[model samples]
Target: MVDAHRTFVIVGGGLAGAKAAETLRAEGFSGRVILLGDERDHPYERPPLSKGYLSGKEDRDSVFVHETAWYAGADIELHLGQPVTSLDREARAVQLGDGTVVHYDKLLLATGAEPRRLHVPGTDLAGVHHLRRLAHADRLRNVLAALGRDNGHLVIAGAGWIGLEVAAAARGYGAEVTVMEPEPTPLHQVVGPELGQIFTDLHSDHGVRFHFGVRLTEIIGQDGLVLAVRTDDGEEHPAHDVLAAIGAAPRTALAETSGLAMAPRADGGGIAVDASLRTSDPHIFAAGDVANVDHPLLGARLRVEHWANALNSGPAAARAMLGQEVSYDRVPYFFSDQYDLGLEYSGWAPPGSYDQVVIRGDAGKREFIAFWLKDRRVLAGMNVNVWDVTETVQGLIRSGRQIDPDALADPSVPLETLS
Candidate 1:
């Protein structure tokens, strides 16, 4: 008993697109649904590609959010390996690379971002890889296995999530790793410097070499093979392989071509989205990493490329498309599981702008939760291998209660009692 008339078309088969389609069905929308993805594989999780999948510990099948049969059973037509070339906004149809245009009543653009490439020379040399897609991970896995991780030198450029995850995965395979970060702290802009310092300590203790305030000038290679990477400081880092995880640029080419308004950020690229996740075009909507949703609390538009974001925003977009009113107000939360150290952080404080940093437990021993406060309000908190304090601490924060600095610093006093 499918409603065969009202057509709903979703582009991009990543987490956001897949989840949105599923939620549409669950909400009793039996309309004709078509999901188009560039990749042939089923909609899979990309987060594990940098960790579990790359380490050869997790298989690619485990990366999918739903099985192939789920799409078939849901009566949703899925077009994989078919790259859409252009979006016809006026006609409400998507033109595929194959010269076929698929029409729809409602269209969704969950097309995610693309990895920003290294501008330095020799970046195109062999043995230099970018970790964003499953195929990329598979290629890197084969390269790492052949290099015999125990002694291979992995020079990772950029201290972002992909780079750090690759470094941690390489270390899991016993590869010697060196990470080059232009910023002093890896999560400097996100969590602020204090909590970012604790992250540096955790990675450092894991035997990962980190260089801050440095940039790669040129990559040296021999006949298409990477040999060494030179820095702005006139230092050359020789390595067997290079993991370039600088960051990602929003895949706004299609949006840009469609004349949608691009959101401006002081740091550069991001696509603008309204309160309901609609773009400049009232007929279209966007989700996932590509769209910058305005932070309801901070009154700032932020683009988050975290798994929780994809999972949460997908349903929100689906609801909005269905003419239902909804708000994307979940405080941004992200986690990095490096070696045995566990890090979970929620919200972002103003940069270099915390009045006080309350610490529970000891960061020296690598067990503590740090809260950054501004105007006696909890702006952000980071739990380093300290799970017991997260829920309670986050509650106190959500309740908008001010916490005592001394009581927070003492491990003897549980964070819950302070409120």
Candidate 2:
């Protein structure tokens, strides 16, 4: 009972696009569904690329979002390795790279972000790498294994999540790793200096050398292979490979060219969308890392690049596209696994957004729950080596209730009671 007249087209072949297509069917939308992707591989999740896959604990097959036959069985017309070259907003169509133009009644852009490249010299060397895509991870995996076996060195630029994760993986493989960052501490922007020190200590304990308050200026290579990297401080570190783990920028070129409203760069630029995930054009919607949402509860526009955002936002956008009332007010959530430590973070509390950081349990032992509060209200929380309190932590944020700092910092006080 599929409707042939109305067509729903999804661009990008990541988790967001794949989940949206699945949700459309689950919601009983029997229209023609077309999904376009630039990569030849089927839709897949990204968390494993940095964690299990890179660490040699998971196989490649575990990354795919669904079996190859699932798309065909779902009646989802998937065009892989064909990128959308241009968007025709007026015609309500998009032209593929191979020159095929497909019209849509409703369009969803789940196009994700790309890793920001290091513009330093010798970046074109053979051993320099970036890890935003599966291809990159595949190559880096081999490189890390080789470097580990040979006792080679890896110099990483920017001690962000990607860098630290890779550093941990390399250490597990017995490779010498050094991280260079312009910030004074690791994850300075996300967790702030107060919590960043925890990561600094963690990585340090694992033999990962960190160069803080310094920028990577150049990569010295010999015959197209990385040899070492030089920093602004005039120190050179021997390196068999260099990884640029700086950050990622949203893919907004197509949206901008189609004349869609864009968020300001200051607000983390992307396609501007309201709470319903609707863009300026009613027929078009956006989700995932490419969409900057004007969040209702946060009262701020946010563009989250984490796996959880993609997992939730895609289905939310699918419902919105089906003419269902939708409010995507889910607090941003993400988790990281490093060595023997695992942590889950919920809600948003970028530095300057909170006034105090209250910790329960022992930070020195790396088993604690840290709450970032502003005006006695929990803005965000992170649980390290702590189990199954994500629900209670998110509840505190959603409740927006003023909390007693002493109670929040006491392990004896249950978070459920506070909310």
Quick one: best lDDT, which candidate? 2
Q: lDDT of model 1 at residue 197? A: 80
Give every collision pair in model 1.
Answer: none
Off by over 4 Å in 2: none
Q: Count the backbone clashes (under 3 Å) in each candidate.
A: 0, 0
- What stretches of model 1 exceed 4 Å from their correct place? 267-269, 388-391, 412-414, 417-419
Worst 10 residues of 1 by lDDT: 265-274
Give the TM-score of each candidate. Answer: 0.94, 0.99
User: What global local distance difference test value does model 1 have?
Assistant: 0.82
RMSD of each: 2.0, 0.7
**143-204 per-residue lDDT for model 1 (tens digits):** 77766544778889998778877877887777788888899888676666766787687778
